[model samples]
Target: MFNTYRLIGAAAALALSTTTLAAVSPQDAAKLGSSLTPFGAEKAGNAAGTIPAWTGGITQPPAAYKTAGQQHPDPFADDKPLFTITKANLAQYQANLTPGQIALFKSYPDTYQMPIYPSRRSGSAPQWVYDNTLKNASSAQLLDGGNGFADAYGGIPFPIPQSGVEALWNHIARYRGSYIVRRASEVAVQRNGAFSLVTSQQEALFKFYDPKGSYADLNNVMFYYLSFAKSPARLAGGAVLVHETLDQVKEPRQAWAYSAGQRRVRRAPNLAYDTPISAADGLRTADDTDMINGSPDRYDWKLLGKKEIYIPYNNYKVSAPGVKYDDLLKVGHLNPALTRNELHRVWVVEGTLKSTARHIYSKRTLFLDEDSWQAAVVDQYDGRGELWRVSLAYLKNFYELPTTWSALDVFHDLQARRYHVQNLDSEESSTVDFSQAIPDDGYFKPAALRRRGTR
Candidate 1:
């Protein structure tokens, strides 16, 4: 892991030559509602009619979903798989399958399969978010290369993205709920099918999504997050607090940790990049936490256009209240029986490590769901240019917030035959609370971490 000082020094040097790109023109921005979805996705369905047109997405919870904390019921529960792609028929679907996905079939031909379902353009954002996104199309600009964004507030930074980094910025700034609280678990499953769950109660206040906050009010800070471990006795009471920054070049992400054993709070600068996630047991990296996070300075990103592919989407079943983690987790991959894949158009972006940069992943190809601007799949390659890890984000619409976000994220290490999954909370009494009140700034300060860690 790069130490804090070194990382900061590297960021400063990279910021010097960071090219500034102009925002989309007003003429192009005008296409948002006429020919594109308000979020900049194509408004019409594909010529083949495989992917449906975007109507206003599911904005209200089903009648059965009566409370804020209940598991999200699948609105498309009655739908059936359109087709199943297995090793035998993999060649027929090669055009839609990512190389890393095809590799999965080759590695586990007997068990790996993709049950492709009809595409549903179910991703939606609040009306205010849509309005702000339109404003951002002509205002948002990348600063310090792509390490920072300016002239943007409360919505996707670059809805009509002109570059790969801008597309990533949209994903990074996509609207989830302003405030949320949930109990979830992370597990590192070994090749032998053995695993232990590390449960955590997490709360987050997305300053970028705050309806009242403006670009000036952000002060370079994007969000404040607090997470406290609740299980695996040894990890209980351990907590982490993060102040994710918008312009990391100006102020690197501020993070602190409270160790139960020491009963003390300490700065945690190694929470970014290839640093092994402690709870993940080295199976995943810190940058891989949310499919992708932190600075994009280490790699030169290129927009690879869009393609139709099978990606995990509207995955309410994978997060059903009573589903056991054991049933979802398997040796090589998550149980395919519970996984749902759909054919949707995704914006593909490739990131290759800059010669001056340092990290484990030499190359990474990320697929962002056009509807939500969230990464659905990331294929990571190692130093030798060999495929190493595949990360998948299973998404579902939190209808109350009416936002599409990850229900579960999995990182599969092909070489080790081990995988780590986060956001598994089926066993918890409550799922997620989107209506949680916004927390005071003081609640997320470093000093308060010590008090919150005494769990």
Candidate 2:
């Protein structure tokens, strides 16, 4: 939890400070499309399966929630897709391609090789992908989450399956952890009334928790992603997303989505007036530039538990689209998104560590997953904790609800090395609507992020 990061790799030279940002113009390599899991997971393993964790962990009894009259349906298209991606059926499916996904769909990237914007419905790919089907949805998944938290409304035909350009850039860099619902009128009219969203193959009828347990634990709680449209290489539309920001937040903002090709959605007006980082300083680390609504912080009331042990989420379980659940947990305290959940089943904590940790591996460790708070697994140590890094996160049920899958595994054991980031894009966009009011030139300088570009 707090070994301070357990310094020892030889910690030193730490005195960070680098203001003067002002650049903005970076949306090309898919805006550097990083941080889906910007290196998470370090420990939490051991439960049979041999030191590689997360294999479904919902304890039991948690499924059977329909609610007749009030309102509730598309909790991700009524829980379906164990498989179904398109572009004219994608050759009865190709076992869900993955060699890093045929090397990014044949290296296609002219904005993901577009030649069929012919009105937005031409998407075709087969013949054995004769051309590797170009590539470019650039990633996405959070179209609608059955109203996950409330007032976050986005919906746009996502709950994806997969096609080409890695199912459109992994469905726009993973629309983000699909599944949500919580509404007491946002705590009785905006105290932040619980919310959620989903629609594209509905299914969220889960309110059991251990229902005499046999299989379905309601996908544990909900929040899941990983695509090749449900692998083995069924590589149809393709995706691997993860994104949920509010950056160490109190209110940083995210949920924007508009991309017609990086058109605009990016956030950051003052990111709630800057100043909030907890860790990460360099080494390809840019997570704390403070972008608020444009996105960068995944909610700040962290907790990361002490350590229960158990790493490697979803060890390898492909069967989403409304996941029923068999196993996939990398637990600790819990996932930790918005806040408040005092050690639920047992054990507690929320998150704290960002007076600027400057991540190049600042000795991090977290293995939460008490049902759904989320953290799963993460443990990096470089200031000298002598572990290097290792990450894992797992959660299932994409459209039907309860999702979160970090699956990040990096072990540099000093050098026998390793690398991973299967984040694929998470969700909970970060919410917004503090009430109309949108003008800081409309997103702070640099021509307002090159006239806005997060489409």
Candidate 3:
């Protein structure tokens, strides 16, 4: 097994020009991992020590990939920034450093800054994808899903262009859901802070009749798994629940325009997810997600470098009929007339498809859009090393909410030209942010898959 820390750690040793591995204190290393960057300093003309702007330039594509412009990476010997911050030098560039960046750099010795890459529109990628990218890039942010389940579940805040509104939407997407609602305060919760979320059904909102009485302590929280674009029974319906965003909301939230299964608009907490985490395999939070156009043994992921990628927004005049805004990640099916006619992009990821023979396309490469951290397009190759599938994501505008590449549609060139689309954004819900605590759900459990129709 590739030891993540060891491999990355050894790279540090080599860069420092040391023959032996340098033993950094675990506490310091952990601090770096939490907030510090993992890059080195660029000694260009920053005597003023300005926080680095687009050193790679603005929204223009590189003239050529190999010719250097932005693709040329000048890696550092150690985890530092192309720019460093010091008390004396902080005046000029302080504006650019995020509060988190300033604190971490001051606290740790080798704290680095996350390198910034040029936007996908940097004059690279296919021509057609560019036209659409410009139109959709704006208005991209998170929203609320409201009590993602049950009768009282209604209304949500989404696609808020204003940073303030967007921030609140993100707050809703992150906190509201079926969970251990530790405390519900009037403000935001931190990573280590205690708070509970509504769950996927089986509980109702606690009405405070007496703050200190038996009603004060409740066992369940009401919530639901908003089905974005869950595949048909053949593909396994179980893929629906795990990646629930509307299910994750702060206090204020919104709902999808259409809810397919019910033939009527449904509320949050409609379908509950009540189970134990001990039933799942070794997976982390946000790992219990659905697969798009996948087979039994064909899902291997690798972390690649961070590359700027441009993706489609509201470019296409067409609309996805059965999905919602939140189901962008797990698409169901798509109309095949589009061809490779959708959006194209420049992404950064090194994930590969599993080597199993079950999946027609045994090899896959994911391209993630950095501006939004969305996996926009994918190249799927068959066992024979042939390009078998090409997947594209289509996003929609939910009011003022951010233009989300909410839907992922893939078409296989091999076999019968069969296609599968995983719509993480079904238009019913948008901004599907996987909760930090959900890596513990047992939805992927063998027994749950066997239960069929359990959702």
Candidate 4:
């Protein structure tokens, strides 16, 4: 493992070049399925063989998962943890731990722990996505200033990314299915571990991945989203609509909110960066929704190169239908016993706030999964340059869809000693329904919000 780490470290230096706006050369693009995984991950394992080579990920659901939106069973349920990292012995594994994770140990030494399981590369996508990814390798080019890209539609825009911003765009454009509807809740856990549930029903139409659609047909729109609050007396009957754009700089995200009291749909331009997410009780920002989103214009992004780190993966237990929120949400962090961690390669990228721009975070370090382009762990620093919060995506393979997505996104406020969690559907009747039929574009418009709102 030590030798392999050294080898990757040396290669990383060579990979971090100055030119980031151009697409990869034809010769480099040819390495896709041969030397690299279909989605741009290194196909071979490290020298120690602890991390296995990429076989075609889990393309089919296990026999246990009988339905599309039902609880997914763990494919590696029989595997056991190799070791556990705790405050007492954290120093031994400090090299593999992120600064945010180390801070968690200092904040809650007794309770915070990570059970490291054997690595599994279980990230997969449909064949069409793979085909498009190969084509994008040589054609996709970053928009002049890096706010977005051009000539990329169905798959990851930059499978062989040349810059930090390019890699970040991969996460933004990664496949999450064409249309999806999920009934979930978000909770802000207080310092003492108390919380209230803010449940909502959310739907999204990923236009970028529409099989019948093309890049020109997108019309600068990436996806259409609509969310309706479903629970708790005070926050119920409200709705939010968003038209997420491919080039946020060309045109910022179009958003509108329907207030239950006023019965009006008003433009919500404040839904962008640094705006506090109401559902999170000011613990997280709107751009922090999917770990990181929105325009990259405010920050100067840099590819910090790749590293082998222990991250939350294959964490099916944490969101199992049988597990109640009361049992999962604990003081300091989620119940460590229910979460699973594994060693995997990730592209580390740092986003430093541009000197001329302003935002809550001074800097952020993101660890993106190599196979799925999912940001698994993110460390956010405050204006004082102190680590303020840690965001973790507990990833699990929805083998029915054959894509790896987060089961729950936990944003931990280190200073406040509170944490906000999104996508808590264990108590709901079903999980994310990717089987939803595509809705008409009119369904996500501002006028639709008014019709859907009921006070």
Per-model TM-score versus the true fold: 0.95, 0.22, 0.31, 0.96
Judging by TM-score against the true structure, name the best candidate: 4
Order the candidates by TM-score, highest first — what do you get?
A: 4, 1, 3, 2
> How well is each residue in 121-165 modelled by candidate 4, as lDDT tens digits?
889998999999999998898774788789998999998766678
Cα lDDT tens digits for candidate 1, 1-455:
11111111222223224468778899989998789898999888888888888998887788888888888888999989988999999988878878889889988899988888888899888899999999999998889888888999988888877777888888888888899999988999988989988998999999988888899998889999899988989988999999999978788898999999999999998788899988898999989989999998898887766788889998988999899888888779988988899988888888989999899999999999989999999999999999999999999898988899999999989998889999998888878898877878999998788876765
Better of 2 and 3 by lDDT: 3
Query: 1-455, model 3: which lDDT tens digit per residue?
Result: 11121122223222112222122343443332123211111112222322222132122322332221111111111222233334456555544332322333343334222232221221112222222222222322221211222211111112111221221222222212222111110111112222222112111121111112221132122233322223333322322332223323333222222333433332323222211121111110111122121111124333333222223333222233333222221122232222112122222223344344243445555554322323455555556875544544553322111123343333322233223333222233222332223322244223333343344
Q: Report the error of model 3 at residue 311, Å.
A: 3.5
lDDT score, candidate 4, position 333: 93
Candidate 3 wrong stretches, greater than 4 Å:
1-300, 306-310, 320-346, 353-361, 397-403, 407-410, 421-455
Q: What is the C-alpha lDDT of each candidate?
A: 0.87, 0.23, 0.27, 0.89
Residues 365-442 of candidate 2: C-alpha lDDT, one tens digit per residue? 344333233443344445554444333333332212223332222111222222222222122121111112222212
Error of 4 at 260 (Å): 1.5
TM-score of candidate 3 to 2 decimals: 0.31
